[model samples]
Every structure is written in C-alpha cells, then in structure tokens.
Target: MTRHHSPTARLAARMGSGLALGALALGLASQATAAEDYRPQPDQTPIQSSKNESFFGKTMDYIENNSYGRLGVLRFQYYGSSSNLHVDNATGLAAQAFGPGGSDLPHTGSSAGNTTTLGAMIGLYLPKTNHHLAMEVQLAPPLKLDFQVSGDAVDQSLAPTALNGANGGSIPTGVPPLGKNLGTFKALPPNFTIVYRPWTHTLVQPYVGVGAMYLYTYDKDVNNKVLNAYGEPSLYLSKPVACVGQLGSDFNLPNNMFLNLDVKYVGCADVKSRVSNIKVNSPTLSPTFGPVDVGSVSSTNHFRAVLYQISFGMHF
Candidate 1:
C-alpha cells in the first residue's frame, strides 16, 4: 500500500531495520570465532596416574628421612630338630667298648634322635639391599648320644694273671651289655649366617641364607664297662664345624611384625673323638695302651640334619 506517509515515520522504519541486522551480524560473529585451547608452561607436567596413600609406605618414608639408625631387632625362635649319626672311620679295638655296645635309646646306634628347644637371634641389615648378617644360638636340654656296650668286664675266674707270676684275682662280674650316656651333642657359639630377600614389597617374602656352626660335647660320662676295667673313664670329642644352607618364607603382619617359616640343612664333618687313656687292667696292656698311644681308642662319626625354624620378629 503506497499510501502517503510522514518523513518521521519513514526515518523510524529504517532505524528499526538497521538495529535488527546489527543484532544478527553480532550473533554470527560470536558463533564463527572462539579462543584456542589454553597452553601451559613447558616446565609443568600433567598428572598421568592416580594418587597412592599407603600407611606403611608413608611411615617408612617419614622414618627414613627424620632419623638415623641401623640397628636391628632381636628375634626369638622355638624349634625342633632331628639328627643322625653317620660313622665314617672307626678304628682301634679299644673302641669296641664304646661303639659296638649299641645305644641306650632305640635309635642310638643307628642314629641319634630329636631335640626341641629355644633360640635367640640378632642381626643388622645392609644399607639398602636385602642382605643381612645374623647370629643365633640354640638352648635345649643336652641331647644324649648314647651307644651300647657290654656292661661288665671279662670274668675274673678266667684268671689269665695266674699263668703269669702274678697272684690270681677274683673273677669279674658278668652282666649283659647296656647303653651308656657317653656325651651330649649341642650346637654352640660362633653361629653366623647371611640372609637375603629378593623384593621389598611383596605379599609373601622369600629369603635364603648360609652359615657355619660350632658344636660342643658335655657330661662325657664313660660307660660302666670302661669304669670297671680302666682306672678312669672319660671321653673326648673334636669340635665339629658344619656348613649350613637355608630356604624360607615370611608372612606379613600388621605393625611391622612378621612370622617366618624356615628350613635348614647342615652339612657337617665326621665326629672323630680320641679317647686319650685306656690303661688296661693287664700289666702288659698297660704298656700297650698308654696316654701317648695311637690306634688305641678313636672313632669317626658323620652328621647331617634338618632344622625347622619358625621365627616371630619385628622391625625397629
């Protein structure tokens, strides 16, 4: 409708059209242009993994940084062991009195038997590795190593002395063979072992070790047969040295405590002991078997045993 209209009305209409076009242009510009992704400084590194919060790890870190210490804790162990006697080189007719008599215990002559005992252990860990140096001692009632023997001397009625110029003596009593408590086998000091672990953080901890042992014999009471024939009856044993090998695993517990199950195989040399004096009841044997004599009374015994050690320990 081309109707006559005022100049003011025309001006108003043009202004309204211009304002609407301006608004549309502004909205399109906003849609077309946007800021690029923000960039960080080269020194900054982005997180790649989740955070960890282990109580044990945090405690270890705190102790390592704040304190200076290397001393380790003391561990106590209760154990049971079974041992055997392997006689290697037994010489001298004199040894018949001590060895052939058989043993007092059922397993005596065939093998010495078992022991149940307590032990104390101390150790220090190497700087950063899993290696440690430790020493231990076993305290149990002495294990008797009893062997069998004829309990009496040759009958005095068979008076060989009468043949000689000497007066005949009364016959010695005749009694059956009996087992005598010769000595006690014990594992003593200078016990040293090296222990090592493969990993620090593990569900189950595994370890290995090797070491040596020094053994001692006590209460070496001679058999009754020897006491009747000889003036003095005593025994001697050479200290045995053994090589040890061990394998074990530890179970983790709370509060820095652990329980371990361990097994050890000890390889030992023959137990060769020299019975120093066997002065014979006969005058001629007196000269033959003197203190300074060899091949008189000496024996050899080999030994190997397994020890199961279960230990309860804690770290400081």
Candidate 2:
C-alpha cells in the first residue's frame, strides 16, 4: 500500500534509503578484501615429496650437511707407552751407608729402571670451537720396574767373612761389588690433559697439552740376600704428583681411524722411601757390635720420567 506524504518527509525517506545502501556496499567490500588476503599465492604453495622418502633418509641428509654431526663428540684411543725413568740416589742413611767408603753399618740407596706398558685414552670435544679444544683422560696399567742399590761393600773387613758366610747371606763379594738387588715394583701413572689443535681438517694434526699426573707405586719386594740377613725388611715409597706437558701428532687414516705419536714430560718429583724392621744378627754383625734392634732408616729420592706413546684412535 502506498501513502502520500509531504515534500520534506519524502526527502527524509530518500536520505535514509541512500544511507542503508552505502552501509551494504561497505560490508560487501570488506568481505571481498578478507577473502583475497587468505587465498594462497604461487610462493606459498607446499613443496612436493616422493612417497618412498623416509625420516631416516632425511636425518642422514641433514647430518651430512652439518659440521658437528660429521666430527662427532667423543674419541677413544689405545696405546703402548715406554717410560724412561731416572731416579736420583737417595740421601740420609742411604748416602752415608752406600757411599764409596765402607763402614761397619747398613748403607744402600735405591735406583729405578725404565718400563713399558699398555694405556688407553678417552677424549671429549668442547662445543663451538670447531674441534680446536678437547679434554682427555689417559690411564695405564701397572708397569714393572726393577730397583737396586749401587755402591761398594758395606764393610770390607767383614766382607770376606760375610761373603764366605753360610749361603753367602752377608755382604755381596762380587768382583766390583755391584751393590744389592732390591727387587721389582709396579708403578701406575694416570693423567688428565686439556689439548689444543691448530688445524682440524688436515691430514696431519699436531696438538699440545698441559696437565697433571699422579704416580702410584706398590707391590714392593724386599727379597735382597744381604738385607734379609739382618731380618725381614719392609720397603715403603711416597706417592708423587706432578705437572706434565704433552706434544703429539695424529695422522689420519681411512674409516675414521688415526695413528698418533705422543710424548710427555713429567716434572721433577721428590719421592721418599723408608726401610724398616732391622734386627741385628750377631752372625752378620762385626765383632765389636752386639745384637740389638736398629729401628728404621729413611731416604729422599728425586724422580723424573718421560713417556713416549704410539696409539690408534677412532672418533665416535
């Protein structure tokens, strides 16, 4: 139904209709803009993949492209070491008694020989240094070392009687009197080092390290014929801890294996030793002496050692 109205009312009705149409057009434009924004473009398309490809294959590809994955984090090595050890002659009773001039008293100093042993090393690579720095721990089993006393006869006057005594249990009467044999011992040395490598990808990589080492000696054998005449003798040694320096080179081989030559120098260490349980045996003693307890004798010895090692290593 249509109703006639005044001119002013007709103009107002027209204005209201124009406003409603403008609002409807604005709503339609906003909807169109949002739809265009969500639509995928050429650059936003998903990449295609082969159906036969696997997660393991993708992981291996990623590892081959990464540096850390190629170099690994841990290394293991097995080696053989030859140690050249030099121990200075002991002091105290050892010096006075074992000196060139002989007296009617117990005198002898201890000397150590060199040894060879098997060893192993484990190393860890530090992060973010491109394999330039690492920490290593090296260990070896007990090595056998022979100890002896070096000097002239204890008492030249009683030397003849002692040499000719029962079972030759007195003084050693050899041509030069080559001292007394103190027997063998076992020494174990272990070290921890921080190593630096200058070149990582070279065929021959050289490294230098500084560290600390500890020496432990045990299984003492005091079976000397001359010392046993007095009584059962007990031998004791002080453990030494010292600083060590290392220099080494590694030659790369196939299949992640390497051949290494390493040299280490241990600083001078002072070691002390004691020999106890000395009972005077009248038979071996001079005529002026009587049977009595002589207590114990102590000596100070200085030691220095150099280790040369050849090793085979693998990275993991």
Candidate 3:
C-alpha cells in the first residue's frame, strides 16, 4: 500500500481533474457575465407615454410604381326609337275620310336607325392609396340605323263606289295603298361618360357610368297620303338629344376583349317635325276646289324610357 502509483495512471488522473476544473471555471464565468448583462439598471423616469408607441416610427412599406390606367373599346348596340299618341277622334275623324288609317302595326317607330358603331373609350386611374375606387372617362360615336315602315290593308268601302256606276271609286279602294318608302337617316348621338370602378385590377370589374347623349337627326321623308284635318299626310319625328345613365359590368379577357352588358336609361328631350300641307285636285268638281294649304303640326314629347343594350367591344 505504501508503494507509489504508476506514472501512466497518475498522468490519466491528473488530466481528468484538470478538465473538470476548467469546465467548472468556464460555467461560473458565463453565469457572471449573463447576470451582469441582464441586471436591471437604475429606474430612470420614463418620457410621456404616446399613443403610437408600439408602431410609431415604423417604416410604412409600399410598392413604388406609377399609377395609371387606360382603356380603349369598340362596341355594337341594338336600339329602337318609339312614339306614343292618343286617338283624338273627337271631330268624327275616320281613317278614310279624315286621315290615313293607323299604319297597322303602330309603325314600330322605325328601329332602322344606325346599329353598328365604332366606339372608342379611354379611361384614367386616379391615384388611390386604398386600391378601392377607380375613376375613368369614355367617349363613343353615333350609332347608325336602317329602318322602314310599310303595311297593307283592304278598304271595306271601296266596293260600293264601283257598283254605283263609278269606274274606280272616288278613291282607289281594296288595293293596298302605295307603301311609303321613308329613307334612312343618321340617328346618332354623341356620347360622353364618366365611370367609377369600385374594386379594380381584378378579373371582373363592375362599373357605373353617367353621360350625355346629343342625338343628331335629319328630316324624315313623309309620303303623300289622304289629307287629315291638317290637309296632308302626317308624320312623327323622334326626339333628338338625350341624357343617359348606365350600369354594367365588364368581363375582361386575357386577349384584350371585353363582354359588356348595360342597362341604359335615356331621357326624352324633344322631337321636331316638318309636316307640309298638300292640295289634292278632285276629278269631278264644277269649280276647282283650290289646293288646301296644310300648316306644320309639330310636338315635343315627355319623359320616355327606352330599350336595354347588351354589347361586346374590344379593349386596347
């Protein structure tokens, strides 16, 4: 027991003891450093508490880009013009004796206006921080139309005149009267619009537009028919110049095409007419009943609600 340990065993034991002491010293030093770093400093008086303490001075990150939007469109619309009147026959006005019979189908008031139009629309996007509202402007040219009014009817009173020794009754009877061929007119209105987009930059955009319609119309050609109380055939003219309000949606496609459907409300302004008097010479008259001079009969209409338009256009 008194003999000293071998050198190898002593060296191994010394190495283990040195390693343990080094680890213990390193742990103590780290503990001291952490405690010193985390130790609370003297309580200093705090500055006045502000409302935006947590988020104040934070960088408001935003995308940096020029804000601008544009749109070009070409659309086609189908529309018709209409008129209304009451049968004011208080003066015993018969179709044959007084005036021409009702043009049978109410004349459908000539939808034959311009149908095809090249509408060019351009809009701008106002700078908005909340990406919600979008403002735009649009201009569209006139819509052209081609319309005609024609019909046939057999007069019931024509048979009696021929039986009474009259070769061709006082007036041509039974045979349909010559159909009036009213030529076409450029019934177009210049359109200007202001549009607003609620949510933009998406696939489908819903918008509302308000605009003015300046309708352009030429004189309508009226055929010579049996004179009315006014002494000549009568004609009606559709109103020119209207204001419109539209609500619709645009389905934007990837290939620069849009499907637009809108409900349009047109305001009735006024209609101008040019009705001339005609003098008809009678075959059996002792004294020539001179041609009666017919004066102009014109009228302006009240508010009217027209048709709806669904169309397609190209976007550039």
Candidate 4:
C-alpha cells in the first residue's frame, strides 16, 4: 500500500488519538475519588478520662523532678497515755541516803510519773522525693506531767535509828498520797518525722509519718521541802532518752491554715537521774543538811504516749 494519504484519512486518525487520551484521563480521576473514600477519619484518636486522675497526676510529678523547695510547719498536740512511767526507785540514792560524800553506789529509789502528756510541735519540712514525700524534724517543748506511784507497802524510811543512833527511827505518820507534781523542764531532744502527702486538697489530706522523739530537760527546781522532810533543801536534773513512734492525719482549713492530730508511743529506757535533798532535825530548826548526788536512777520499758493535736501552718 504505497498510495499517498488523503485529507479525510488523516483527519479520522487524529480524531481517534484524541478520544483515547480523554478515556485515560477519566479513569485516573475516578481512581483518585475511590481511594479518598477508603482512607481513615480524624475522630479515631485515643481517649482518656478525668476521675482516673489520682496522686499519680502531674502535680506530684513535679516532685520527682527535684523541684521541692523549703518548707515549715507548726503543730499542737494533746497526748493520751498508752502505758505508765516506771521510775527506778532502786538505782539512785535519795538525798537522805547520801551522807556527806558523793558516792556512786548504783543508787537506789526511783520515782514514778503519770504517762499522759500535752505539748506543742514546731517543725521544718524538707523535700526528699519531691512533693510526694518529705522529712519533718520537730521540737516538743517541756510538758506538764501528772504522776502516780503504787506498790507493796514498804516503809520509805527504815528505822531513823538505823542511821542516826536510835532515838529509835520513828516512822513518820500518815500514808503518802496517790498523785504528785514532778515539776517541769525544757525540751532538749527534738522529734524526727518522715511525712508523705499524696495529693494536696481543700478539706482533708490523708498522711502517714514516723518519728524518733527525745526530750532533754533542764534542772528541776523543787521548792516544796515538805516532800523531803528527812533532810535539807535541794534540786534535781534529769536526762531521759525515749524511742517514739507515731501516726496521724491533717485537716486543712481556710486562710492558709490546718489542724494536725496524732497518736504516739514513747518507749522507755534505762534512766540515770540526779537528785539532792535536805531535812532539819527536831529541836534545833537550824539547817543541818547539804547538797548530795543521788546517782543511777531506775526506770522501766513503759513510758508516755500522747494523742490529739490542733495546729496552724503555712505551706511553701
């Protein structure tokens, strides 16, 4: 077929080419529309709720970041007795027993006191594990203690003649009463507490803590000479170390305030106490005694435990 192409033949061929290109474009458009319909939507993201939010919230997370700073707290407490204080009457000598020389003869005679105590607490709170946990070291001031003593009825004094050449030891008349005031002193040993408050709230906060408490007392000035009728005027100083354990809750109030109440147990230890006593013989009212050292005061395993606390504080 070597014949030259006619105009009509060329026009027909160009028209066929144009029709094929149009069909291909239509197919591509349709495919794109179908693919869009098959794709996923925007609403399918993960979902979470609010009530599940607990102490594990971002609030406590800051504490883990080493962001906890300085803090201070104050508390007032009223403690109840869990046990009785057993004063060692056998370890230390009474002033009446020690003649003129200060002898350390594993002294005898121990005085017992009531276990209940009421006191105040001042503390400095330091962040250890951020805001979730902290260290609170506090001071409990000298507290007024009520005391009692009881046992087999034994004469407090042997025959006065046993020591003074018998006018014959005349046993003093009248039995001693059940209760007495032991006097007050300063707070030397403070308390150490490890505190944890999970979430800070408006009304109530649940907290857990533990502590080691010590009370160091000053020289007690005993003025009532009637208690020591066997000798002259005197004074005493005592140092007692007690191991303490505690637990409690804090109720936060308005105006940067709060209330703290706690129950605590103070374990007893070996007590070494100092004492001085005096007395005047009949006839010559002149003072016939001087100060003496009564050493090694006896104590037992049971001591004081306290409850109830009302306080106010500012948070940092």
Candidate 5:
C-alpha cells in the first residue's frame, strides 16, 4: 500500500538531476567568457593621437639637440692701467721721497696684454624646455699673456716724476716714455655662461649670453728692465674676476658638425699689486743706497679694464 520505489530507480533519478545541473553551470560560464571577449564594434571613428606619438613626431620635425661639445680659438685683447708705488718691510732706497722704506705714494702706470689661444666648452641641452637654452662652461687657455707698461716721464734714476695725482689724466709730470715688454705668462680663464640660441630651426644659429669669468695667471716670470736697472726684478699680478657679455653664431656643416664664431667683452677688476726684491744702488734716490730692503720694495697697481675677445669654434 505504501507504493515504495526501487533503490536503483531512485539512484538513476538522482544521477540524471546532477548531470543536468553540471551542464547548466558549464553553459553559464561559457556565455560569460564570450561576453568578455566581445568588443562592441569599436567606435567607427579613428582614435586621437597619443602624447607619445605626438612627441616622437615633433622630435623628428623640430630642431632637436643633445649634449654639445666644442673646440674654439679665442683672440683676446686686455686693456687696463696701473696705480702708484709702494713697498713693504724697509731698508731699500725709497722711491724718491720716502726714507729707505716702502711708501704708499701713488704713482701712475698703464698696461695692456693681448693673445690668441685655444678654448673649449661642454654642456648639456636642457630637456622639455626652450630648445635654445643651454648651460655651458667655457675653458680658455692663453698660451701667452704678453704684458706691456708705459707711463709718465722719469729722470735718469727711473723714478716717476709725475705722481698719480699730479699727472694729467693719470699721466705724470715729466713722465718718460716707459714702454717695455714685461714678458709672457700662461693663464686659464674660465667662464660660466647661459647661452641663448635664438634661431635653432635654421642652418645658421645666432646666440647671445652673459657670463662670470675669472682670469688666473701662472708661471709669471718677469724680468722688468726698469726694475733691473735699480736692482733685481720680480713681478706679481692679481687674478681678476669679471663679468662678460658675448655674441656668437653657429653654422651647420655636414655630418652633424658646426662652425661657430663668438665675441665677448670681459670687464676686469681694479686692484693693487706688488713688484718686489731689488737692491737700491742709486745714492741720489736714497741715502741708504747699498742696502736692499726685501719688505720695502713693492708697487701699487690699480687696474680696471675691458677685455675684448673674438673666437671661432667647431661643435658636435
């Protein structure tokens, strides 16, 4: 009366139900995968260019530059003047007025130097900014620092007759024509400049700049004839710090090479210098003629000058 089903029938029915459920889950998973893979007919219009592609194209079209290295020649003209006579210590014949001792008495003198030498510069081109802007360091080595001095009249004793104040426009009274070569010295003048190239798109590029420069002298062995007439001679000069203004241009050549022309005006400093070590032998100039004063022999050199330079260079 209970209508009991067989155990085999029950087992087959359960297995069939399990198979249908598994097939349904697999079908759902397949549909989800197809949905993910299907892209709805991507917008019919074309996509806008990306920043990267635009940048790449511009790089090829515009004037693109990288690190710049150059070799140049500098033609320099230094114009300046000197100031008074002074010495340290004591015992040498005073320069005319003071007792056998150094004096600060200002004397007048003018000097100038000129040379043409090799120079070089290396720098990196700033990125993502004005293509024309670059920071550069320039190195110029002067093979010859040829200095010459001339001033007011002097007696046979070589004393400046016209003192700095008494002379005309720094010219002294009875000042003799004292023109002599003070010998050549080596110098290293380094400049730090911000170069501005106005037109880089063209084959020829023009640039202007301002810089801070330093003039340093080395191995300056001077045999001053005037100083030697009195005794032994030696010389010293102040390395000056200056401001420079420059103008230049670069012409492009084959194979990523360039020819450059540059001009600069360097304004130098005004300072006092010393000339030392001499035996004062003239009795007329000093009573203590035979004795030499190591400390008392020196000269004051007040100098302010502008250095003009013309340069040529090659760059890659």
Candidate 6:
C-alpha cells in the first residue's frame, strides 16, 4: 500500500474524476429545468377544466366562449330565379275549339320561355335557438308568362275582318300582335325554414334547410292580342303553397356584418289557369255570317312549376 503510482496512471485517474463530476452537474441542471417547467405560472390559463373532459365537452366550451350573441340575425337578400311551367291538362269549350291542331288555335303544352327576374327578400331569424330557424318574405316585379302558340293562330286570330267581326265595327289596325306572349303577373312568396349548421367555430358557416312557401299570384295582365282573339278574354291563375329546399353559406365580416351565398328549389304543386271569352265568327267560317256573336267559351289548364333561385345576401 506504500508504493507510489506512476505519472500516466495518476493523470488517467484525475481525468476520470473530472468527467464524473461534470456528468453529475449536467444531470442536476436538467432536473432543475424540468421541475421549473412543471410548475404552473400565475398568468397561464388552463385549456381544459379537467383532464378527463371529452372532446364534445371541449367543443361546446369553445362554442359557448367564442360564439356571437344569440340575438336574432336579419338578412336582406337579392336573388334571381328561373321558373318553368308545364301544362298538365286542359278542359272546356275553348279547349275543344283549340284542341291541338284545331282550325282556330293550337294547343299549348308548356310555357315557351323562362321567367328570369331580379327579386328581393327580407328575412329574420326567430329569437332564441341560436339562429337555426328563420322566416323570409320576397317580392319581385312583374314576371312574363309566355305560352306556346302557332303562327297561323296569330294571323287568323288578328285578321282585320275577324277583328271587325268580333268588335262589331271598324277596328284599328297596324298594332303588332303579341305572339306567344300570353300574359304577366306578380308573385308574393313567404318561406319558413329550419337551418342546420355543421361548423359553428369558423368564420365560414355553411347550412342546409327545408321549408314551405305560399305563392300568391296576382295582378294578371293578359295580352291584348289574346283579348282581341277571344273578344275580351279573362285569365285566372290559382295560388299555390309549395315546399322549398335550400343550401347556403355565410362568411363573417367585420362589424357584425356577414355575406351569404344561397340556392333554393321550390317544389311543384297543382296550379290552374282558366281562360274565358266570347266566341265570334272567323274568316274560315261562312262569309255570309255578318259579325255574329257566339256563345261564351272557356278552358281550364292544370299545371305545375319548379323554380330555382340563386341569391346573394347581406346581414343587417
């Protein structure tokens, strides 16, 4: 035990002792840093109240904290719609005379054109229910309803002699006839819908809805050519209540304002149109007949139309 160690051995032992001390110091510093990180800070807010909280609970908490006020939203919408009308069946004496290739007038199966117009709607979400239900009312300018008619029907119905025979005197000429332009009318449609929202935490919220609408048609304007043809024809259209389906998305903007894009489909219902007028002697009839007034004739047509609408809206 009294023997002294060599210089190389002593150097190796000193080096190993220094390395063990350094490792011990590094480990202590790492433990101190981990303990500091685990300690909660005074200003830090917990993301969850409990570690066992479910994802649904977290989502609801987020929605409750971040949602806008539950007070209802009012929206003003500008929309355009295209409608198609199909004639199902027709009846009455006028139908008999004009029954598809008859001498007087041709049968009309459907509208010759589409009614494309600009419309406006005002909608309000019912208070409560987090803006999930709404009611909307819409108004549009006069819409033209063009029905199919033959060129021969136009010429024969508006002939000078025929006009005089129907009117019982010399009538004015040179006025152009409204060929296929049957009439025009205005519509008042109101809707009630229940909306569904999939993502409530994002700025862009998309939704779908199903509803019903009452379509009130009024202010009928029959073409003068039609009137002259039938010697004072009166037109009538039945009001219908139809189902509605819609899809849309809303984009939140600054200052409580939002922009919306929407599309809707209005389901078909039984709609009817009736035309009643006094029949008169035509040029094709015997020439000996002198402006003879015939009995009144009428025709009824049952039809339905499906309307498609695209709209852009703004929040109030």
- Per candidate, the number of residue pairs that clash is 9, 1, 9, 23, 13, 0
Report lDDT (CA) for all predictions. 0.41, 0.52, 0.39, 0.38, 0.51, 0.45
TM-score of 1: 0.48
Q: What ranges in model 2 sit over 4 Å off?
A: 1-109, 151-180, 279-294
The segments of candidate 1 whose C-alpha lies over 4 angstroms from its true place after superposition are 1-113, 130-175, 185-190, 223-232, 276-296
Q: Where does candidate 6 clash, by residue pair?
A: none
Residue 58 shift from truth in candidate 4, angstroms: 22
Between prediction 3 and prediction 6, the one with superior TM-score is 6
Residue-level lDDT of model 3, residues 196-309, one tens digit each, is 667656678788877666555543444334333224344555556777786777776655456665555667565443233423332233133333232332223433344344
Q: For this target, which candidate reaches the highest TM-score against the unseen true structure?
A: 5
Q: Rank order by lDDT, top first?
A: 2, 5, 6, 1, 3, 4
Q: Quickly count the clashes in candidate 3.
A: 9
Residue range 253-295, candidate 4, lDDT tens digits: 5544566665555555443433333332322211332322232
Give the candidate number with the greatest lDDT.
Answer: 2
Error of 5 at 185 (Å): 3.2
When superposed on Cα atoms, how far off is each prediction in RMSD? 33.7, 29.9, 33.0, 31.7, 28.6, 29.6
What's the CA error at residue 93 for candidate 6, in Å?
11
TM-score of 2: 0.56
What tens digits encode model 5's per-residue C-alpha lDDT throughout 21-47? 345433322332212121111122222
| Evaluation by TM-score, superior candidate among 5 and 6 | 5
Per-residue lDDT tens digits of candidate 1, residues 1-316? Answer: 1122355864585467447534443332232122121111122232121136344333333223211112222231212222222222323432332333222222322223355454434343432232332222222333444422211212221112211224544322222332433333333333456667675457577878888765555445454443336444445666678777778776767755667676767666555554444433434344444421122344455656666667675543
Query: Which of 1 and 6 is the better model by lDDT?
Result: 6
Candidate 4 or 2, higher lDDT: 2
lDDT of 6 by residue, 133-237 (tens): 444444454354453333433444433332344646643333233366665655544455656767644788898877776655555555545345545555566
Determine which window of 10 residues in candidate 4 has minimal summed lDDT: 34-43
Candidate 2 residue lDDT tens string, 38-117: 22212233222234645444333322221111111112121212121122232333322233322223344455666666
